[model samples]
Target: MTLSFQRIAYEALNVCNGVTMAALEAAVERTGLAPGAAAIDIGTGNAAVAVRLAERFGLRVTAIEFDPVMADLARQRIDAAGAGAEVTLAVAGAADVLARSAPVDLIVALGTTNVTGEGRPTPEAGFTALRRKLRPGGWLLWGDIVWLAEPPAPLRQITEATNLYTDDAGWRAAATGAGFEVITGRISDPAEFEAYPRDAVTAVRAWLEAHPDAPEAASIRFHADRVQAITDFGRDYIGFGVYLLRNPD
Candidate 1:
């Protein structure tokens, strides 16, 4: 599962998820986890959030990304930040890390809803598995696609194939069902939501232009076109949101 284009696109994007830096930092502040607490950022694209956590919030962060390409970039980013000791980059699947690790103070899974589960990822599967990775009262900063309006069958079929999506209420229910207490959740600003795919498409286009003869150009373009089309079509029915949840104290 190498998304080479994603690495290039992330160079131009803020975070892999549609989450803004300000919003994620705010969500971290909401966690109220003190300095020196432990945190793991699953599917941490470029490990930007992880680096921020270790540097600003004084967290001992384990930034996880399975893609070697992205993980390499994250490793370089972490090393250059002089946060080598504070931020540990793990090039492994989230579920693998979660299974073996001790409970931490916070777990941040943004955009990568499949942080847990085998087949199609769902909120319930993710929440349940993640519960074991945190201590009581620990936080889960989760962000993913939410159905703003009922999607057409065609779009729904396409969306669910990658990762299961649901409305805001559906997400809250899944969290509570998995024993997490929902603290707060926010639907993204329309403009911010709009930037996600647009930024990716723009970056990919630029990369393709620069590397026109590259062997992977075709694959990258195909992915970019598919994503751009789907995103454009689904904009009316789907939106992104971040939810802050906590394990029972």
Candidate 2:
């Protein structure tokens, strides 16, 4: 099905996925982390969460991304924030990056697993990979889109075909099996969003306008279109999810 487009405004602030930045700040405050705590954000796109953790809680971050383009953008953002040293943007997948890194106090894989592109990797395996990198009692914050109802055939086909996703319960079960205790889970409140797919669309549009002759414009346009389609259907049938899981202390 065809989808219309929306322009993203750079002036618009990014909204946190499910948990607001304020809530994340509160979590840090409650934890009473020392001046230099460590955190990792798996599949971190543009390092938004990593930047938030550092700026809000004074934590150092290791932001991992497999996509070079996205990782480069994140690196630019981190550097521009004057936080280059504070946040390390690793251009590697979760298993590769986490394996070499030290155990972190927190790991966030927000909206990442869906695109892992390998049958969702069984949440059990995903958690097992993450568990190795988490310090005992460290927290893992996972976020993704889940079906609000049995999705229409088109949406299901799009998701399954792309390895995108729709299994909130399965994630909970996997976390449980992986020895993680769920501390909390919540659907994202629209109010908390700062940066969004709209911004992404805008980014793509601007790139198209500037580089009209560029060879990659078609691919970029296609991505923007897909994002717009998902956004259009998301409100009614798809909900973004976030789960805060912890290793037993």
Candidate 3:
């Protein structure tokens, strides 16, 4: 099978998701995650957040990633970070992993809930499903893109087709409807928002230059151009944020 453009791009960039490290650390601190807490990181791209939760916060984390290539890389990184004992890497979709796993003290799903099922689940449904996997009084650190302003009709349709995001108000309502009390939230600064796609494009373009004769070069370049376009245009109307939510007892 041909490698997916997303997989190739993410692997080249060494990051599969967009949230920044600073945002992640801030979310952890805001959530007040305690040592020895049981946490689950859904869609753990490179297990960056998962490893940090385990190492920095002293939490035992179950990190789930659907893509095999990404999962392998996560495994390598987890081992390299010496967090093998504290972090369990699960190569599976979020819904599947949550199904078999016990309720945990914390759950972190950053921009990956769509992988939970076939159809695009609404934010309410997605948040509710993840909440089921958390223990009462537990915390959930959810991160994803949100609209900064209502885009024109064409742009809105284009974004909706790919991103499972809504405006900040809509997101807060969804969280409340899903039984989560929003405690604190952090929106990405303009620089952080620009950095993710900019860095990805840079990484992929560099890879393309170095591996001009590679079989996947065409696919990689195609994906890189598309991302660059989005980075240049779409970012103005959208922003990424991490929300710290609490599951009431």
- All candidates' lDDT scores? 0.88, 0.68, 0.80
Which scores higher on TM-score, 1 or 2? 1
Clash count list over all predictions: 0, 7, 0
Candidates 2 and 3 compared by lDDT, better number: 3
Task: Name the 10 consecutive residues with the lowest summed lDDT in model 3.
Answer: 8-17
Candidate 2 local lDDT, 133-198, one digit each (tens): 778888887776666778888878876563455567877888899899987766656644323665
How much is 146 displaced in model 1, in angstroms? 0.4
Q: Residue-wise lDDT of candidate 3 within 116-232, one digit each (tens)? A: 465578889888888888899998888888888887777777667745678888889999999999998777888877777877777777777888988988887888887787666
Give Cα distance to truth, residue 72, candidate 3, Å: 1.6
Candidate 1 residue runs with Cα over 4 Å from true position? 1-3
Query: For every model shown, what is its TM-score relative to the native structure?
Result: 0.96, 0.81, 0.92
The global Cα lDDT (0 to 1) of model 3 is 0.80
Model 1: per-residue lDDT, tens digit, 1-249? Answer: 354778888877768777688898998898878899999999888888899999889999999998899998898889989999999988888888888899999998887845664866668988898988989889999999999999999999987876888999999999999999999999998889888889989999988999898888999999898889888899899889899999998
Error of 1 at 230 (Å): 1.1
After best superposition, candidate 2 residue 111: deviation in angstroms? 1.6
Candidate 3: misplaced stretches above 4 Å?
1-16, 115-118
